[model samples]
Target: MPDTRYTFLDTPIGALLLAGADERLRCIGFPTGKGAVTPRADWHRDDAAFAEARRQLSAYFEGRLTRFDLDLDPRGTPFQRAVWEELTCIPPGETISYGALARRIGRPSASRAVGAANGANPLPIVVPCHRVIGAAGSLTGFAGGLDTKKWLLALERGATSRVSEQLSLL
Candidate 1:
């Protein structure tokens, strides 16, 4: 608990709670549901600490940025961390089943475990947890709730399409 600082950033999804220390992002909380977060009793609020994050997130929502580049320090088990890292490999607008993700990590029989890790992701959109779907292609549970997940998927899909359309007209 190295003097962790926190801030709230507003985006299309909703107001987000960001917490971290020493310039590395630790957690990003959604506006509602179990993921909603409020500053802890000892947490300090500093807008300047998260300026770059705010800018990047805003750009993302506005479709100006496609991916996030930031220092992240999400706390989780080694297996969970591996899942989160693999999540980033899922290109925006594309999705895969938990079973597929499990195999990607060389754990073909660990779909359930992969789903669990996805649900427990400390970082959502940045890590792209919303891209993991049910085996039958149905959108699954997300910490930020299904609606937010749908919105993010739509945003990514739309952004990707626009990019492709731009390149094709050249």
Candidate 2:
């Protein structure tokens, strides 16, 4: 059967559709345009777990929290899990190139494969996938689009003030 626990969050970046299984958060995505996605009406709280997730997420959005402290159950292959695990180790304000991440995971020759896994990350911001960049020190593809990706990276480094000026909508 499908997971049942879910919630809709109004975040600084957009509306997030949060789904989970008991205490483990499964996915966090912006379904509609920024701040437009809403949780399913059938979304019923999982009591203890849901409350904790909401609390952590609230802290994150307000920029009070740098790292999350909740269980995550993102669905993916073993390689993807390795990639995500490596991503979590990336310091909050720092970033790593796909090649660097692959080398850290003991697969230096698999940079392209690592890039693929990063792109396939089931969870975006929560997993900190935005911290990964191209080998040439350039930004790359993001499921949420390049603008959102740049916003996230800038937010992490406290460098978003400039983007806010360039993009009035931010």
Candidate 3:
């Protein structure tokens, strides 16, 4: 494997671990739980390597950025990659159920599998897996915990409302 650089970023939820190589972001781990990815021995700390990601994330939190434009190279199974790719298409402040996501990927009966893949997503906020919810619109399982998921959804909603208000003035 190539040399990967990592950095810890403090966010409203908690500190996040960002890892990447060759300018392609590979992972964004939470501080703990299933979402956490331990830094490898070969990994080196380099804030500069993740400056763009950090900047974009900050903008997102501040409601100044709606979409992320960065090179991503998350590692996962083909099905998981498909799920993650579909996740990126979910607009900010919008959400879909696991069943919906499964159908979107041409697997109408793979809702469980899709949820599993979502739980194992290597990148969370960037991939937007948190946007997936239960069929009844309940906040479901999130690698970063349900509270964090609620916070993210609320943040996006607030940002969307703010953007709408700004646009209405024009």
Candidate 4:
């Protein structure tokens, strides 16, 4: 199966699942659907990528960086990969509707399909699934839940200082 090894990182938002194979990161997502950070039990214990991830995440949470420069290996079909590739082009702090994203990928009629790919994104914050909102500008489905989506949006909007208080409910 996926040769991915993983680790958990405690962040201002919550626990982040960092998965990589060798030097290439595969995914980064919320752990346990909760904001509580915890350690991962099984993974490549000494992976260098994990160390780099910790640094990058620290910079991100501190608002020192706006975009990530990490290698990604999200598992999916060709079509889904295409959709995700487009998702990555969406700049930080900016958002697009699912329909808009589908249009960007030249699949204008595949808005719902785009949503599926967004939901299936193994890398959330890094790949920026949070940038895709409902057509009506509503925060929609997120594997980490709506509150996390809200928090991410706020963080991108220069509200990192409030993340600790916002995440306390989770």
Candidate 5:
């Protein structure tokens, strides 16, 4: 697509690369660890393009905002999109297993597929994929790393300052 814009926003976790085209947020990339995303050669850097997202993300990191209100345009398959949509419905401070997530999407037999979709989520925090955990309620792998996931869950559970303190050292 033409006119794809990007900008980096500093957060407690790290610098998140926000990128998309035509005012729609397509991807939110972590700065370090497993899911780091670099800018494309053809993409243009424009902070103003993602100002709203930057503001919302800042509020989220500070525990001032729970649900995001931005125009999201995450790209994925039809099933993945369904899984991601259900992910948004999961309340904050709560965890759901991959099997339960699959059940929520009416594909109860696709727990593994659900996990794969969760792993492929382009927007991590905003999309709430981190809320999905193992069957026994153990923390699972995260695109932004396990520590970031722990902080995110903790922030949702009213440990705002604790999360801030822990992540600020990063």
Candidate 6:
């Protein structure tokens, strides 16, 4: 594999690690936890490579941007990739159960599998894996922890309301 450029950015949640290659974002890792992506010896620290990601992420945190328009190249199995793709389709401020995600991918019996894929997602916020919840509307497991998930959901909800309010004014 080619060398991946990476950098760290501080956010409301904490520090986030951004990695990419050839101008396409490859991963958005948490600072520490099961989902954390540790620094690799081959990885190069390049803030310029992650400038756009940092900008968009900042906008997202500030509730000024909802959709991310960037090149993504997360490496995973075909099934995992499919799960991640569907995850991106989940609008901000909305939540979907693992079973619902499984059904959406045409594998109704693979809720557990879908959960696993969601857990293993290399790109978290951009992929929006935090939007997944339990069937009963409970906040489920997240790579960045449930607290972080709740914050993300709250951020999106607040952003949605702000956008709606702005639209109402116009």
User: In terms of lDDT, which candidate is strongest?
Assistant: 5
Query: Could you tell me every candidate's TM-score relative to the true structure?
Result: 0.91, 0.84, 0.89, 0.85, 0.94, 0.90
Give one digit per residue, the lDDT tens place, for model 3 in 66-166.
78999999889999999999999999989999999999999999999999999989889999999999999999999887767877887888843544454
The whole-model lDDT of each prediction reads: 0.86, 0.77, 0.88, 0.78, 0.91, 0.88
Candidate 6 clashes between residue pairs 3 or more apart in a chain or in different chains: none
Error of 5 at 10 (Å): 0.6
* Residue-level error in angstroms, candidate 3, position 144: 0.7
Q: Could you tell which candidate, 5 or 6, scores higher by lDDT?
A: 5
Candidate 5 backbone overlaps, count: 0
Model 4: ten consecutive residues of lowest lDDT: 34-43
Clashes of each: 0, 2, 0, 0, 0, 0
* Candidates sorted by TM-score, best first: 5, 1, 6, 3, 4, 2
Model 6 Cα lDDT, one tens digit per residue, 1-170? 76899989898767999998977899898887777887799889987887788999999988899899888899999999999999999999999999999999999999999999998899999999999999999999998977678778878888435444544575
User: Cα miss at 62, model 1 (Å)?
Assistant: 0.6
Q: How far is candidate 5 from the true structure (C-alpha RMSD, Å)?
A: 1.7
Scored against the true structure, residue 48 in model 2 reaches a CA lDDT of 48
Cα deviation at 54, candidate 5, in Å, is 0.9
Write down the TM-score for model 6: 0.90
User: How would you encode candidate 2's per-residue C-alpha lDDT over 8-61 as one tens digit per residue?
Assistant: 666766666677776678877765533233456766654444667778778866
The Cα error of candidate 1 at residue 18, in Å, is 0.7
Tens-digit lDDT string for candidate 4 (22-115): 6577777676563232435555554455687778888988778778887777789998899888878988888999999999999999999999
